[model samples]
Each structure stands twice: as structure tokens, then as C-alpha cells.
Target: MKKYLTQFKPFLVFISTFFAAYIIVTLLYKFYLNTFETNDVDGITNVVGKNVEQLMDLFNCDIKIHKSIANSWLEVWYNKKYLVRIVEGCNAVSVIILFVAFVLAFSGKLKTTLLYIVFGILFIYILNVVRIALLVVLLFYFPQYNHFLHGTFFPLIIYGAVFILWIIWVNKFSKYAK
Candidate 1:
């Protein structure tokens, strides 16, 4: 038993740190969400929606995003067509949380970990905004593949990026890196 425990000590530590960071951050996010009114979108989602709107606008695309009067989401209009709603889940904060947790688990030096987390969060946020914009354009042109685009393709992109980041951290930056 002691031998087994010794062999798996690193794995156990990683799992514990990952879960601890994930749960704590998630709970903090939940508390933040709870502060919003029932029919109001949270600030982060609102910012994400605005960023998407601005991004599309930069390309001269006819894009407009407005807070839905009857719900806690932002309505995205592309080329004057009601295409989708930007919900809290669309903000990518959850993905950032997961990324942070993994980075924490495989942490290197304090300065490196903090810097990586900041940059990683920014990268994910920017990628998410661009993803939403691209998704809007794609959905507008390919309405038939909404499920595949939203449920599978875009998720694969974001999560794949995160996975790549994790691999980079583990191999090149984490304390365990050889």
C-alpha cells in the first residue's frame, strides 16, 4: 500500500489541486451570477456580447447585439436576421476556469504560473469572441448545420485550443516538465 501510494503521489496531488481550483472558481462565478437580477445578463456575458458585436462590425458585417428585454441573454442579429442568443455560457469563463485549474495543478514557478494564467485567460477570451463571431456568420449561411456548428464544431475548437495549451504547459513550463 505504501509503495502504491508513493508511486501515485504526483497524480493524486494533481487531481486534488485541479479539483480544488475548479470548484473554488466555479463557486465564485456562481456567486457572481447570483448577484444579477433574474432577467439581467451577467457583466461578463454582456461584455462578451459587446465584443462580438464590435468584432463583426469591424469587418463591415451588419451585426447588432442587444440585451433581450424578456430574458437574461443578448440577442445577436446578423445581417438583420435573428440568428442566436449570447448566453452566460457563451462567455467562455467556464473554459477559462478549467484552463486555470489545469495550469494550477501542473504549476511551475509562481511568476510563470501567474503569467501563464493571465495570458491563457486572455487568449481564451479573444478566441471565444472570434468563435462567436465566426459562428454567427457560419450559422447565418449554414442554418441547416446549427446543431453541429454550435454543439460540436465550435466546442471542439475552444476545448481543443485549451487542450493544446495544457500540453504546452505540461511539457514546456510545468514543474514536472523534463
Candidate 2:
């Protein structure tokens, strides 16, 4: 039993901690958002819905949020009257990935670990905000390209950024042997 556990300890830790942190952060964020006074839009089907009206008033833009449902997943869209959907739980991915990286910091490399985790968290948040901002802009300017932008480009860019950070950590920092 001890041998079996030790053999898979790293993988176990990685997966378990990653998911645990993901769930905790996601729930906390949901709770926070629900408790906050910020506007929460619901059941939008297209760009002309009440949510878009609110967005327009808030941003002073004639642009709107376009809405779509693909594979049963809702997408919030923005348009020069286009559709947008509210994505409630995507931040979990970044938080889990960050947690995994933080765990790796203690695995074999302790040097610069704390600093890396701090910057990693900051970078994740900033990147997500940028991703949201870009999506809104793209939805406004290029409605026809919404599928590709939402389905492919943004995911590639954001995941690619995270991947690069992970690679830099493992190669340059993690295996540095102190």
C-alpha cells in the first residue's frame, strides 16, 4: 500500500489539489458575485435583450451583447448589436492551473517559487480581463467571426499564454536545482 501510494503521489497530488482548489475558488467566486450589487443579467437570447440595454447604458455604447447556445453551453456576445452571453465559471480553469503551478514550486524548486506564484496569479487575472475585453470588441466589429473567435482564437491565445508560463516555470525555474 505504501509503495503504491508513493509511486503515484505526485500525480495524485497534482490532480487532487488542482481540482480541490478549482472547486473552492469557483464556489467562492460564485458566492461573491451573487452577494455583490453588480448587475447580473439573465436569460439573454440575443443582442437586443435587456442585458444589452444595460450594457449599452453602462458603457455608453450602442453595441450590445449577442447570445448563443451551442452544445448546451451559453455564450455571451457583444455586437454593434451582436449577441453575448454571461460565462459564469470559466475562471476555475485558471485558478486550478495556478494551484498546480504553485504545488510544483514546492516539488523540487524552491527558489523564486513565491514570486512566480504571485505573478502567475496576477497574469491569469489580467489575461482573463483582456480576453473578455477582446471578445466584446470582436463581437462588435465582426459578428460573422464570432464562432471562430470564441471557439478557437481566444482559447488558443489564453491557453497558450498559460502554457508558456508553465514551461518557463518548469524549465527555467523548477528544475534549476536551487
Candidate 3:
């Protein structure tokens, strides 16, 4: 039993850290939701929606972001036509939480781990915002591929990026690398 436990220690640590971080982040998000009066979308979702709106505007696209009829999403209109909805899940907080948990489970030096987590979360956040914006544009022009783009390609992009970052961290920065 001791020998088996020793061999699986890393895996154990990883699973525990992942679950702990996920639960904590989820609880915090719930607390934030309770504390605020976000009618349609939560603050983070609203921010993502506004950022997507601004990005679309930069392309000279007629973009409008408004409160959705469904109380948990933000309605996005392209050229005055409803194109997409930005929901809380689209904000990428959950993704960031997963990323951070994985990184913490494979942590390196204190300073390096902290800085890397910060940068990783920021990168994921920014990438998600861009992903949402581009998704809207693609959906607008290629409505036929909406399901594939949303359900498959776009998620792959973000998760693929996270996977790459994880590989880089484990190989270069993680204490386990040595």
C-alpha cells in the first residue's frame, strides 16, 4: 500500500488540487452572483459582451449588445439581427479556474508559479474574449457552420491553447520537470 501510494502521489496531488480549486472558484462565483444585481448577465459576462461589441465595432460591423430576454445571457446583434448570446459560461472563468488548478498541481518555484498562473489566466481570458468576438463574426457570415464552430472548433481552440501551455509549463517551469 505504501509503495503504491508513493508512486501515485503526484496524481493524487493533481486530482486533489484540481477539485479544491474548482470548488473554491465555483463558490466564489456564486457568491459574486448573489452579491450583485446582474439582471441579464453577470458582471463578467457583461464585460465579455461589451468587449466583443467593441471588437466588432472595430471591424466596422454594426454590433449591439443588450440584455437578453433570458435573464442569464447577453444578446448580441450583428447588423441589427440577433447573432449570438454571451452567457456566464462564455466568460471563461471556469476555464481559468481549471488552468490555474492544473498549474498549481504541478507548481514550480513560488515566484515563477505565481507569475505563470497570473499570465496564464490573463492569456486565457483575453483569448476567450477574442474567441467570442470571432465566433460572432463567423456565425454571422457562415451561419451554416454555427453548430460546428460553437460546439467543436472554438472550444478546441481554447482548450488546445491551454493544453499547449500546460505542456510548456510541465516541460520548462514545473518542479517535476527536473
Model 2 residue 104 lDDT score:
57
**Model 2, span 78-174: residue lDDT tens:** 4344355544444434444555544453344455766777677667656665566567777777879988998899888877877777777766776
| Whole-model alpha-carbon lDDT for candidate 1 | 0.97
Write one digit per residue (lDDT tens) for candidate 1, span 16-63.
Answer: 999999999999999999999999999999999999988888999999
Candidate 1 ranges with C-alpha deviation above 4 Å: none
- The list of candidate 3 runs beyond 4 A from truth reads none
lDDT of 1 at 68: 96
- Report the error of model 2 at residue 61, Å: 9.7
Choose 1 or 2, whichever is better by lDDT.
1
In order of appearance, the predictions have TM-scores of 0.98, 0.57, 0.92
Q: After superposition, how far is residue 59 of candidate 2 from its true place, in Å?
A: 15
TM-score of 1: 0.98
On TM-score, the candidate that comes out on top is 1
Best by lDDT: 1
